[model samples]
Target: MMLMAAVLQAAVVQPAPGMLVERRLAEAIPLAVGDTVRVRALAGSAQPRPFVVAGVFEREADPNRIARNDYEVRLHLPDLEALLPTHDRVDRFAIVLAPGARADPAARWIESVAFGTRAYGSAALAEETSATFRVVSRFHDAIGIVTILASAIFLLCVMVIRVDERKRDMGTLRLIGVSRGTVFRAVVLEAIGIAVVGSVAGAGLGVVVTRIVNAHYARVYDTTLRFALVTPRIVLIAALLGLALGTIAGVLAAWRLVRVAPQKLGER
Candidate 1:
């Protein structure tokens, strides 16, 4: 929970660079340290002077966890004061409280003293955002469960059909002295192969699709909304699910084969 701030001191005082910019802003403008950047003033405002790029900072953790405006820029007090129509007016101020201090009482006191002041609690905002994420996560989980179940059912059906088609071949092998255990193992191995290949391909395709979507959103909205994150844990889960599905399908197919006698199968 490191807090970052940009401070402006006397012009004579030398600081690390001049102004600090967020990583995302730097990327958008492609600015480097020592580069001079000029910002155009909004309507009815005087023109802004150029400021040197001091440093670029990035959010150490996920941006969603922090309450910040990525597009906001911080400048030295002197620099900002020079740009403002008024010499010493500020839009807002940030106050950091000591650890374990209650913010409500302080906020109330501040509001009472200041006219038209609004106090917002960061904790409340964080809690609300977390709740929203939880709901969305549950929806995604429900969709994933439905998808997996549907895939399992489809795989089971396909394997059953494939086994039926191979009944004559299986009967010929059994007639030639192939053991039931060997036939079962062969069918199970084939199912496992198909599942493994399908799982790898599917996972790869998902990663590519997610990357593309994220890229599009970044370009359009200037935000990083990675709906799908490909990690080791995710890969492991996908692999395990695939193996489980394959095992279940293989067992069902083998069980059906065992129910029919080899002689009967050959007759059909």
Candidate 2:
């Protein structure tokens, strides 16, 4: 799946010499527009021939986006047909929709026939491209959840031990007029402190583990897998989970202390 994502990201197309329509002339030839050059027509001619460089045109003006242009050359369609013997097969066709165009009928028809097209809108393409990354992201979230769950269980056990060891101390405090609320607050604060420390350490460990996996797998497979793509939202979510888990563990551990007999602890 990772390999598929990489390939899809890398896939690019360029125009051939014989093709009449090309998106960008800048990409087709090394020289600027109006620069004359010799080229053999792949479709119309039997041999290499000379041709003039027509004026260049821009296809799309979005500087940040990939440019898909329509190159106007001096060759006719018949010339293209004559150059290639296998003219029976058309490799690709470009179509543009009118403003507010709808292809629902065509789409329904295609679906009824159990077929699909590669043509998609920019938004659709973006969604499809991001889907792979989303899957990988969810996998990372699963790892975080597992870490938090394990930490919660361990902290609960530790709280249980501390409660047992400090029972006498707590009893004395209670006798001296330390309210149950104060004792509860102290225990909760301590648990939160432990959770915060453990969570920070766990985050650092996660980064190291991710780096090691990415480096080892990339070296073995000769592929790039980026593991440092952390976002603020993801980090925030992880932190909240850790905090909530910690609170739950603290509550469980404090339950027994809160339920102690007032008389037995000399609170009367």
Best candidate, lDDT-wise?
Answer: 1
Candidate 2: which stretches are off by over 4 Å? 1-118, 122-148, 221-224, 262-268
Weakest lDDT window of 10 consecutive positions for candidate 1: 1-10
lDDT of 1: 0.79
How well does each candidate superpose onto the true structure, as a TM-score?
0.63, 0.52
**Model 1: per-residue Cα lDDT over 123-148, one tens digit each:** 77567658767888899999999999
lDDT (0-100) at residue 162 of candidate 1? 91
Candidate 2, 42-157: lDDT as tens digits: 55546654444454544433322222223445465655565565665554444566778776665455357533434555567567667656887799789967866787788899
Q: How many backbone overlaps does candidate 1 show?
A: 0
